[model samples]
Every structure is written in structure tokens, then in C-alpha cells.
Target: MNLNIFIITSYSFFDQDLEKLFLCNLKYQDFSKNFKNYENYSKLSSNYKLDKSKHWITNVTHLFKFSREFKNFIKRYTNYYLLNCLIFVSIEFLPEKIASVVLGFISFQTFVDKFGTVFSIILVTILQMSNYHYTVLILTTFYGSWNLSEDLLIPYFNKIHFTMSEQNQWLNTRKGVLFGIGLVYYIMMQKFPLISFIIYSNAFFNMGFLITKITNEIPDNSKSLGTWSITESVWDGHDKFLGESLTS
Candidate 1:
């Protein structure tokens, strides 16, 4: 997957406001402290140097890296150029579906490439879960709640398909009931104090992702991984998960 293209797209999006990158790069501590003027600029410059190192890979330089697997993969898929040409070359035929046409073209490239890296930055931005950079690794991966230990054991559950109506009812009825129970639990949780605090903490943090399910709006596409919905919420919230057995 020619990741140079995705890197360029990430760069272009950030380039829209040049100063924002600089401002966000500044150490919040120093700005709050408001030290001597010259010392502030010098510290900011030093901080910016480290920040650039963190963000540079997301810039133009990630285009090239040594990988024998990458070369062999590209060699095996020599038809991609022809595919790109054939798709765009026939675009004018769909005069009525202009949006669909453009979308088809973009999706073709993105699908072929599997745009994990580009969209990840946007997801991380929305979540505000990681540093603008990865902080520890060379790339921004596993935006939050990731650790080295037991990375493999964490199970991934894909579509255990439920019909939209069943899914909706599960979310609206079951989840709404749990949410009401959760609210009551949260209100009186202070009585037990510590145990209640733990329950409330986990509940509020968890309810962050579940509020969508308590409504009937699962996103149409599931190609994007780890895109959670209310189904997971009710399964956890209401103790009625069918596991991988259920299917649409």
C-alpha cells in the first residue's frame, strides 16, 4: 500500500493552518508559568525541535523505507496502475451520479491501499486519546488504552450479525433501561462511597461509547475496524450478549 500518498494527505490536512501545529507544539506548562520573555522563546524553540521530530514521519519523509516484502507485494500487483487508469478513465459515463463517481474513484484507491494510517490520525484527533504524535513509538498507533502486555490475548469480535430492528430494540429498550438504572446507581453511589465510586467511574466512562446504541443509529459501514455501536453496550450493560453465535 503506497503509504506515501496517505502521508501526503495527512500533511495537507495539517498544512491548512500552519500556526496551529506550532501552537499545539508549545509546552502548556511554560505558557502557564509565563517565564522570562527570551527564555520562553528559547524554550519554545527547543520544544518545537522535539515536536517536529515527533511529527516529521507524518510529514513527507515516510515515503521510503526498506522492506523486501513491500517490494515483492508491489511487483505482484503491477495491475494497480492500469486499474487506477481504467476506473478514472471511465468516470464521465456516470453523468448523473457525480458524487458516486468521485466517491467510487477515491474509495477504489483507499480500498486498494486500505487507508489505516490516514483515517487513524483523524480518529485520534476526534478521540484526543494520544499525543499529536505517538509519544513513544515512531508512529501514532493504538491511540489509547493500548499496552505492550497481553496485546495478542485481547479478542477481536467482528460481525455477529443482528438485524437492524433487533439491534435497534436491544439498544433502545435494553440499553435505555440500563442507562436509567445506571443514573440511579450513579446518584446513590456516594452512599457506599468507594464501591459506588468505582461503579460510577466505570459506568460513566463506559457510557461514553454506549449512548449511540441506546438510540437506533449504527453507522452504515463496518469496514472501519473498532467502530463501536450500542450493541456492545447492551450486551455488556444488559448481560444478553449472544457472542459470535448470532448472525443476521
Candidate 2:
């Protein structure tokens, strides 16, 4: 598998982007332990120069040919994410299970679109009256946070050279996003909260979305679908969470 990965990665420059990305972000998951010495972390921060290094290689900025155009794309993309999240989170608590109806209507539209709004309100209605989890609901606010963070945090994590502990924290954050959904659901006995967090908090601006697209390889090998732009939908098997609840 390693050789195959190398062969696939080395053959095409696009593959190199993937290898570099995985190595840059996924590979050194544990070096943070050594950095726990504080001195090491300080050295890293100094050497890396946090603020100055915001635009790491292959991020959204460099990837999109037109910054203005990309911003528009991000606005649409973020809206889509926030909208679906609004729906999925809503359905989690609904006793009657509008998942079928919600998903059916949503299936026809991308959340980033205007149509997303129509379905979102409808789903929110279904869940508002059903069994829900407040803890999960509160934490799920992070859905928007995660979405927002993805445009910034995930890539930033990728850019910074991390220590093992730092990497662990990173992994935790990523996993927590998924695990919390399920854990909270089980604990809360299903009664959840209002569906405004994701929508009201971030108003689908192009800035963050565009920021997510800092990378520039035509075929992005870094992560899902060649998009250095953040806010991707992934399947962690362990994290079907609201996705499963809503889709089921």
C-alpha cells in the first residue's frame, strides 16, 4: 500500500500534491509530545511566524484563478453547508422523523443555494417538535464553527509544523466533532435546541470560504475533490452522527 501510494503520488504532480498534503497534515500526527516542553512550541511558533504564514502552499487563495469568483463560490458553499447542517441537526430530535421529507426536498438542492433556505425552515419545523438533545444541540453549534473553522483552522493546522500533543489535540478536535454528535445524542435522550446557530452566526460571506481555497493545483490532491477550500463532507464511519440520523 505504501509503495502503491508512493507510485501513484510520485507519477503525477497532482499526486505529489496529495503526498505532500498528507505528509504535511496527516503524517506527523505525534511530534507534538516533544513540543510539550513549551520551549519547543515557542521555537516552532517563532520559526513558523504564525500570522505571516497564514497563506501556506496550495491553499484556497492560490488554487482559484479568480479570487472574486471563488468568494462567490465560498458564499454559496458555506450557505449549503450551514443549511444542510441546520436540517440534519433539526431532524435528530424530531419524534416523527422528517428525515425522509427533509432529505427528499434537500436532495434536489445544494445548501449553498437559495432553495436551501426553503427546505431548511421546513426541517427546522419538524425537529422543533420532536425528541432532541440539548447538549448535542449546543455542541452542534460547532457545526457552523467547524464549517467556519474548516475554512481556517484545518488548513492552518496543516500549515503549522505540530508536536505530538498538538497533533493529538488536532485529532481530538476532528474526532470530537464527530463523536460529540453521537455521544450527546445518546446522553440527551433526544430533546435538542433551536436551529439558528449555523444560519445566524455566519452569514455566508465569501471571505472565509475563499480563504479555504488557498491551494492552487488544478486537480487538488490535498483533500476531497481537489478543493483546498474547507467545509467538505466526509464519512468517518464512526461519525455518521446527524448524517445517519437524518438520512436514516
Candidate 3:
């Protein structure tokens, strides 16, 4: 969209503090090592330079620098999105009784867009495996609460990590927990066909997005291409579901 709008949203969401863009222009090593006195640092001001490279076009391909990860990400996510579109069509065609059950998939899509596809997928799978209507109801409320919690907690976590010397230890611990959780979901997916389909589809979406994140350095755009892609997908899904009602 508009550059100014993108910057404002990114500043609000991605850059919680004003420091990120400032730090991007600075050499972290220089600050860590050469901070003897204010005078010395002030004198060395001319040494730092901003990177002014061209950004990627947010298309399927880049001319000079080919990102294999980006390519694979596109391929995987396109397949997943198309499969979800098919599921939507099938849901639309079903009888009212069956459609009511399948209608839950629309809620799943909404959750996926909000909390992230992978996390939402795992959560829905867990709800399905629980086989309790009350449990599902509880989790639906929990998800809304959890989203609010993240907006407060994430900044605090980022501050803590920034200050702590044992940040790597905390990172490792978080990774271990995530891995364990993912493994549990994997096992759950094996038992349930619906869960399996959702888990795989969401996994594809998440994987592609993650790969794009890892390869973000290749793109010189200050705005996140991955964020744009997700927004585009969400709109596309919305249009597909609403059909001509979206226009009205």
C-alpha cells in the first residue's frame, strides 16, 4: 500500500520502541566496544553509513538475487491457500446440518489470520481431540484473551531479553517448549483426518512465512513483505467467502 501508512503501522506493531530504526543505522559492535567517552563517539559520527539498496518487488521472483527459500515459500503457501479455498467451496455446498459443522472452518480461518495459522491450527486440533463442546467454548474465549495478553507481554519480554545477559538461555528454553508443543500437535494430527488436513495446510502457510522471515535480509524493503502477503491472503479469503456480498 502507501509507504507512509506502512511505516506508521510497522512503527506501531513491529518496532514497539523508536530504537529499532535508529539501531538499524548503527553498528552494534561499535557501540559495545568503542564506548569509552561521549567525546570520542561524537567525533566518530561520520563513520556510520546508511544502507540504500533497492527493495524486492514483492513478486514471485527477483532478477539479480534469487532466493530459493522465497520460491519454496510461495509454492507451498499457494498450494495451502488453494486447498483452503476448495474447503470453503465444499463447505458452501453442504447441507445445513453438515454446513453448520463445516462452518466452524470459517472461524478457524479467522483465528488463523489473527493468532497465526500454525498456532491456530494446533489449537483447533487440540479442541477437536478434546471432543468437548465446553472445552472448545473455553478456548474460543481464551484465544481472545491471549491476543490481548500478547500486546502487553511481548514488549515486556523483549525488554527483559534486551537487558538479560542470559538471553540465549531463555531463547533455548522457549525453543524447547515450542518444539515439544509442535511434536504433540504432530501426534494429534496423525489420529484425526480433519486435524491432519488443517495441521498440514497451516504448517505449509507457517513454513512459507517463516522462510520468508529468515530470508528477509535479502529484501531491502523496510516494510515486511511477509506481512503484506498475509494481509493479501486474508483479503482474498474474505472475498472468496463473501463472494459478491463483499461489494454490497
Candidate 4:
């Protein structure tokens, strides 16, 4: 495999967008003992300016940032992490082709997407890390299918729902809209064999459905807060415990 291909595939498909974030947001203070090889890199000065004094500082920064982000992602999104882990473990037990198909479909989800590249890299790193192998093919296929579903199909479905609900009384319910959307995919798969891969996978559709299920589980008042955008200041109730604010 070419160096460029390995780097692109590993960084883009495998790491998701984490590698990009790590490279872009690296601060000068990142060269501490948290990173394996850079224990002494930043110890000399607390106020050192970033420059090319050391060529390998960026590489060390990548490792430190990756470690921190990976831990934080797993901690804050524990359920999402566990689901991806389960999917990864399933790859070992299932047939190679079947596992690849499932992995590709699951990669469409936001949380699983981040670890997809990492998982792909780990699979091939020991024996043929540089080779552009089946892992790459499977992940890229899944990622592409996911993109098509999200960018094209879901928006189309939403439009159809809105149009039909406005024109027809019978097609106004949520169930009616869902059924109509599923019917569209079913018809497409039946009529056009070429696009069957995307129609059958339905990765984005499943994600939307799962999220809707979770959203319905939340209590009424809490759901409103969940969707609201917060700007700068945070609210903390005082209840005269520490004296009321003068403005209040």
C-alpha cells in the first residue's frame, strides 16, 4: 500500500474526525508526562513558544491528545462506547463477510463512527497495518452508504412527510409518515437492483428511529431542556442560601 493511502484511510475512515481535532487543537502545554515519548519535551520552559525547534513535538502532541479525547469520549458516552465494543466483539465470532456488513452499517451512527477508524487500524496494525485491505473496503462502503442515507434519503423522506401531511388527511400521523418512508425504500430496492445495498442497509433510518425512541423515553419538561441551546451564563438556584443577587 502507498503511504498516502494508508495515512488517508487510517486517519479519515478509522479515526473518524478525532485525528483532525487532535492535530488542530494541540496546545503548547500538551507535551507533559501524559504523552509517552514527550515527558521532557515541555519541562524546560512553562512559557515556551511553538516553533520548529523540535521537529517531532507535533507527533508527541498527537498521541497525548488522542489519549485524552479517547478517554473523555468513552466516559461521557459510555452507552455509545459499549455498543461499539459489542459490535467489535461480534466481528470476531461472526463470519468475516457478515461481520464486515454489520460493522459497515453500524458505522453510520455518530458514536460508532469515531471508533470505526480506530477499530479498523487495530485489526490490521499487527500483520499488515500498511496494507489497504478488507477493513478499508468494509468501512468505506459503510461510510458511503451512511452518507447517502443521511444526506439524500432522510431529507427526501422528511419532505414527503411534510407534503403528504399537508395535502392528505389520512397521511398525517407519525406512523403513516414512517410507513410511507419505509415503503419508498422498499420500492426502490425492488425496482432498482443496483442501489439495493443502500436501500437494504438503512443505517441512517435506524439511527433516527433509535434516537426517536430514546427521546420519547425522556420526561416531558426535561425533553424541552434537552433541545434548548445554551449560550454563556449558567443558572444556579440560590434560594437565599448564600444571599440573593442584587439584580434579582
Candidate 5:
């Protein structure tokens, strides 16, 4: 078990993803320091566009209800949370070392990769039906932590013009490290859900810095793990809707 834990831990930290987490923390600290300067503080305040006269709760509610980005975050968070839970449950039946290896490999796959998603979902459903409530709960919290960590680097990925497929492939090929970096941010977001948006603002710069470092180290030679018809269909539908929305 100790060896298993060490293997998992080593794999997760192999690419120094934890360094990216630290980088984000340092960036957040620098951002907080800017609040001490009136000009810098005012500049920062202008970006949020929150009305002072409104109740804080009302403003937050509005942000949750109407912010597209927030909605997308919620969607991604929920999906990944569930997916990770299933993955954790699936691996639990295996021996420690084998489980660790399986976990690492699956984590490297894209959420929608081929039949993996369907298989995981089916397995999770079977387990849930078997009444493993306590086990599922624990795994959900464990796997969900670093699941959405990639969201922080959206700005960098966008700047580099990486499509969803490309992004997944790239991350999949260089897995473990990004998961480690995301774990810290995930804990922070859980502890301070309301302030996540603010944290994300600072995270953008950190992502840019981290991505530059990552790209320099890892050459982008990630090949596709085959196409998922469902994913492609969804993307196509989304593009069609976007086109119509723009035209109208």
C-alpha cells in the first residue's frame, strides 16, 4: 500500500505540476498586494463591473444565474466530479499497485475518450445500484478535487488556439502533473466558492506563465486517441447554434 501510494504520488508530481500550483499562489499574493495601491485597486475593481448599491448576495446570485462562464464552470465541475467518482470506484476493486496504475492511465484519457466514458458510467451505475453509498461519497471527494484544474489555463489554451481535442490530447500525454497543480486550487475553490471568480482572474496570469514553461519543456506531439462520435456531434451542434445566433 505504501509503495502504491508512492507510485501514484510520484506519477502525479513527475511533471512538477505542483510548481504550477505554487506559481498561482504567488500570483494571487501579488494580486492581493496590488490592493494596497489606490490606482491599481481601482483598475482591478473596474473589471468586475459589480454595482455598489446592490446587496452582495444579489450580485452574487446574478453572477451565478447570468454569467456564461460561471454556468460552464458549474457544468464542467459537476460532470468531472461524477466522472472522477466513478473512476475511483472502478479502481477500488483492484490490488493497490494495479489500481494505482489503472487510475493513472484512465486519468490520462480525455473525459469523452472513445468507450472509456461509457464504460465508466455503466460501471458506476452498477456500483451505485449495489448500494455502495459510503464508498462513492469518499471517492467523489478524492477524485473531484483536481478534476477541473485544467479550467485555470483556458486563457492560455485559447491564446494558443488549441481546440478541445488538441487540448485533451496534449494534457493526456502529459498527465499527472496538471492534476497535482489543480488539486490545490480545487481545495481553495471548495473552501471559498464565492471568491473563486476573483481567484480565477489572477489564475489567468499564472496559467500564462505556467503554460509557457510547460510548452518549453514538453513538445506538442500528442496524437488523437480516436474520435468520439458523441463529442463530435455535440461540437457540431454547438457550432451550428453559434452560427445561427450570430447571424440572427
Candidate 6:
């Protein structure tokens, strides 16, 4: 997981930085072509420096910024986590007979998604109900692996400028790989709870090298697993709210 995270983050960071450099160079080229006055050129250079300083400040204080994007991400993912828990708890509270029926319904929904969400709740519920304590513990470690993958890949997604639908499509197509990466991350977290963040920072670079290799070698037309309707709806709603908030 750490390696995957590292790879994705490294690719995204370098990609974005290269893009910025390209754009800045182009702007300078245009400015030079126009043969602006020395004072105007000086002003333009100062403005660029000012913008860079502001960007640095923003990065330094990002954790305390509470920007709209951060708020939206937190709200959306929190809803997903709560919805998953609610589904699991509701299933557990059902009578054994009815629980089976509910499980069938969940199975149907997952099938409709072509097993895109990986039927995670169904597996967890079954394991718990069957009283497979050790198995449940192990499975639980990887239960929210998808979410972890999504969290770690945010930089990559942003760098590529993927729309909501595009993001979902990309994720669905790579579900198995992402899940495996996330499972490794979960294992590390369990093994090194206190120093997990430090470990993650180091592994991030390692993951970037792997990502570079994978992207270079693999074609993009791989088969997709399926999309998560609930997640899609939540993202849609979040976007709508943001749009309306901005308009008003």
C-alpha cells in the first residue's frame, strides 16, 4: 500500500509541477515576444514571485485551511462510511431469516454493479454472522481498502483533472489493483499504528516509481468491475451543492 501510495503521489506531484513549469515558461515567452517596457517586465516578475509565495503559504497551512474542496471531500467520504456502517448494522439486527433476504438484495445490487463495490459489506456481514472471529478480523483489515485507495490517489486524480464520472470509471476499471494496494496499507497500519504516517511518507516515493512503470507498460482499455451507485449519487449531490453555493 505504501508503495502504491508513493507511486501515485510522486507521479501526480511531478506531473503537476512539470505542467506549471511549462505554463510559466510559455507566459515568459509571450511576454518577451511583446518586448514589454523594463518597468512592466519588472512588475510582471514581481507578480509571479508574489503568486509563488502565496502558493507556498497555502501549502504550508493547508491542514488548517478548511477550504471548500476539503470540506466537500470530508462530507462526501463521511457519508459513505456512515452508509456502509448503517447497511452492515441493519443487516446484523435483522432476524436470521430476514437477514438472508436482505443479503440477497445486497447481492443483487452488487451484481447490478458487476461487483464493482466488491460486495464488501456482504462478505463482512456473512463472516460476522457465521462467528468466524479470526477470519472477520483479517477481513476487517481490508474492509475499507477501497476508500483508502481513493484517499491516497486524490493527488493523481486532481493532477489528471478527472471529472466525477471519469474518476469513478477509472477506479472501477482498476478496482482489483487498488484493493490490493489498499490491503497492504491496512496491514501496515495494523502493524505500525503509531509510526504509520511516517512509514507512509517514505513509501510514497517508492510507489511513484512503480506507478511510472505500470502506466508506461499497461494499456488503458482494461475491463471494468463496476461503479458504486451510492457513491455516485453522493458525489453528484455534493457537486450540486457546490454549484448552487457558488451561484448564490
Q: Which candidate wins on TM-score?
A: 6
Q: Give the TM-score comparing model 1 with the true structure, all chains together.
A: 0.17
**Please, what are the lDDT tens digits per residue for candidate 4 over residues 22-68?**
22222222332132112221122221122346555564454345433
Better-scoring candidate (TM-score), 1 or 5:
5
lDDT of 4: 0.34
Whole-model lDDT, model 1: 0.32
The window of 10 residues in a row where model 2 has the poorest summed lDDT is: 1-10
Q: What digit string (tens of lDDT, one per residue) describes model 2 on residues 1-248?
A: 11221122122222233323433332233243222212221222211122224454444444343233234335534564566566666567654355544543443342224336767565545644544453234333434333333332332333343443544444443554433432433233223223222222221222222222231212223233223222222223334444654686
lDDT of 6 at 179: 71
lDDT of 2 at 238: 35
Model 6 accuracy (lDDT, Cα): 0.44
Per-residue lDDT of candidate 5, residues 138-222 (tens digit): 3444455444455554323322334556656666644554666666665665567677645544544455444433442222222
RMSD of each: 22.3, 17.1, 18.9, 21.6, 16.1, 14.9
- Residues 1-248 of candidate 1: C-alpha lDDT, one tens digit per residue: 22332232234222423223223323232245442222322322110111345465643233224222223233323444444444444444555355344434344343233346667445434433443223222111211111110110011011223344544454344533443444454344434554643443344333323332233233334442124343443444333332321431
Best of the two (1, 2) by TM-score: 2
RMSD of 6: 14.9
Residue 138, model 2: lDDT of 35
Give candidate 1's error at residue 215 in angstroms: 4.0
Candidate 5, residue 189: CA error in Å?
1.9
Question: lDDT of each prediction vs. the true structure?
Answer: 0.32, 0.35, 0.35, 0.34, 0.45, 0.44
TM-score for each of the candidates: 0.17, 0.24, 0.25, 0.23, 0.37, 0.47
